[model samples]
Target chain A: MAVDKKFVGKTWPTMVYEVGKEKVKEFAKAIKSNNPYYLNDEFASQSKYKTIVAPPTFAVVFGAKLIEPIFMDKELNLNVAMLVHGEQEFEFYTMVKAGDILYSNTRIIGIEHKEKLDVVAIEIMTKNQYNQDVSKGIYTFVVRK
Target chain B: MKAMYEKNSIDAGDTFNAQQKIDKYRAIYYAGASGDFNPIHIDAEFGKMVGLGGAILQGLCTLGFTADAVTTWIGDPGRLKKIKCRFSLPVKIGDTITIEGLVTEVHEDTGTVVIKVINQNGGDVLTNVQAEVVTK
Candidate 1:
């Protein structure tokens, strides 16, 4: 069955995630990155950003928090077992630093039913405590029947 | 050391390669870091039950590697302006992913890099991988 096209514009409560310095370091380590911008405090303190900053793909860490609600929503009824990530995109604006409170909003942007699979897309827009755009991520998934 | 792009002058044909040996615990650590605890990524039995063979690595984790290759080469994380890719294969434990990046185009003030991500078997793991950075 095809995902309801009517859910295209459906949205959930906006999620607020606080970027933590240690959490950033943990994520950096998981990706096997030892970038000073993400780890070294004194080195990053001397850099242009003036402090530890999250990696470019760190957007996914915050973005993942919002994705869970969508995947678990009974109304959407996503086939969790058969769904696989199809594609991902990220456009970085202002780098996210520790101690920044980010507000993220995600919505169902598209739901297309193809011959072999159903493709669902959700776009997430995030901004910081300063209301500056942090980054935008579009996560696409393929649900095989 | 981190601002090498500003020093090296990134141009067309410039290339760099980064390799990662995906350890068995990669997914568990990734799940803790990224909040993706899907069974297909962490539970081997569940993953096999679902026909994934065994616990597979998260697609985002693989993309993280792809982005890291570019930022590592460019030397400035903020200089990486854009990145996108499609997950073409399931990366499992013990797989070695090789990320090869080529500066395919350089415009007046920006450089475009085309990336090829492949597993040890030479199978495409992620396709259409690309990133763009500020050059000016």
Candidate 2:
């Protein structure tokens, strides 16, 4: 069944994630990066952020909090078995640093039904403890019908 | 951001490239880090059963690779103002991704970079790749 278009603009509750230094290193290494900004704290301390930072795509880590509930949302009733990531976009306003308290919110921005697949786009907006916009990600998923 | 940009001289027509070999266990590592343990990415048998031929790397991980390439060149992770891409093809474990970037345009504070990411097979794994970086 296609996800109901009525669910467009639907939103979930905010999620809070405390960026961890080790987790950031794990994510950076997973992506095969040894960038001093992410892995070398002494190097990062002298840089603009003044602390170890995460790669911009780290938005997905915190953003995943929003995705899980959406995938399990009874009303959405998405066919998780058939779904795949189709597209992604991220706009970074501030770099995420270790120890930052991130507050993230998610909303359904789009839904389209075709003959054989359904496309859903969700927007996740995140802010740091200072309420500075850290990043905004548009995650698009395609489900084969 | 300004202090970081002071060290690099970015101009239009500048180009750079980077590559990452998607080792067999790369996806598993990514799954642990990103919490995207969808079966098709971790189980080759399940992937084949699903008609994917084999377990595939997460699209976000591929994007992460590209982001790494761009940021490494720009010299500051924080200056990457925006990036967007369409996942045109599945990147399998053991596939090496080659990222090439061209600085097509530049202004006083930001530059527009067009990125092309291809796999070892010469397939366009990521299309419509573009990123914006702040210079000052």
Candidate 3:
């Protein structure tokens, strides 16, 4: 099945994700990162951030949540099993903290079909509940046929 | 925010080292967080059947560790703008992966930095990451 090119510009519904301290620590531990900046508030406060900070890739989990609707759409002809994370990129406008309430909106930026692969790109823009843009990510997935 | 970059800057080919003994508990925790419970990453028997001698860690988990490396080196947590990478190989349980990164490029206008990571044993290029961070 071919993916709909018309869906390239389609935008998914917004998702609200609450950043938590435990989640940050879990992600840090999972990666075996002993960075005090991510684990200890006291150490973090000593730094310029003045608070605990999240790892760069912490956005991957939340980014996925914001774009869940697109992958869940059957009409996209996307097979979850055959999908592989091809590449991901994030652009940060501001720093994110544990207590921040993040609101994210995702849009499909590009789609291309080759003989045996479907390349799809999704862009997620995340902002704090205060409506300040924090980061924007462009994720590309390769769906094997 | 105070500027930390003024005091330290990581150059390309600069190495960062750390270790992890992939224990059973950590494996389970990763499975829960990543929602990736592939048998090879959890069940040793299943891992052997797939040609791996024992359970292996998820690629994302390794990538997460790489992200931690960046945060530690930069001395800031929330300032990471981007982290992008491609998984080139698999990491098995009990294997202590030493994550290392080099500053490949820096965009002065954008304050973006590019960093690349390689597993210590040279087993796999775990992550090829580019980030736009706020530097001093």
TM-score of chain A of each: 0.98, 0.97, 0.91
Off by over 4 Å in 1: B1-8
lDDT of all predictions, in order shown? Answer: 0.90, 0.91, 0.70
lDDT string for model 3 (A49-125, tens) is 77776776777768756656676787776786677667766676777777889888888899999999989999998
In the range B1-136, model 1's lDDT, one tens digit per residue, is 5554343578889899999999999999999999988888899999899887899999999999889888777777888989999999999988999999998999987899899999999999999998988765
DockQ (model 3, Cα): 0.50
- Each candidate structure's TM-score, on Cα atoms with residue i matched to residue i, is 0.96, 0.95, 0.80
Return the interface RMSD of model 2: 2.6
Q: List the residue pairs that clash in candidate 1.
A: none
Better of 1 and 2 by lDDT: 2
The per-residue C-alpha lDDT of model 3 at residue A59 equals 76
Interface RMSD, candidate 3? 3.2
Cα RMSD for predicted model 1: 1.4
Residue pairs clashing, model 3: B12-B103
- The top-ranked prediction according to lDDT is 2
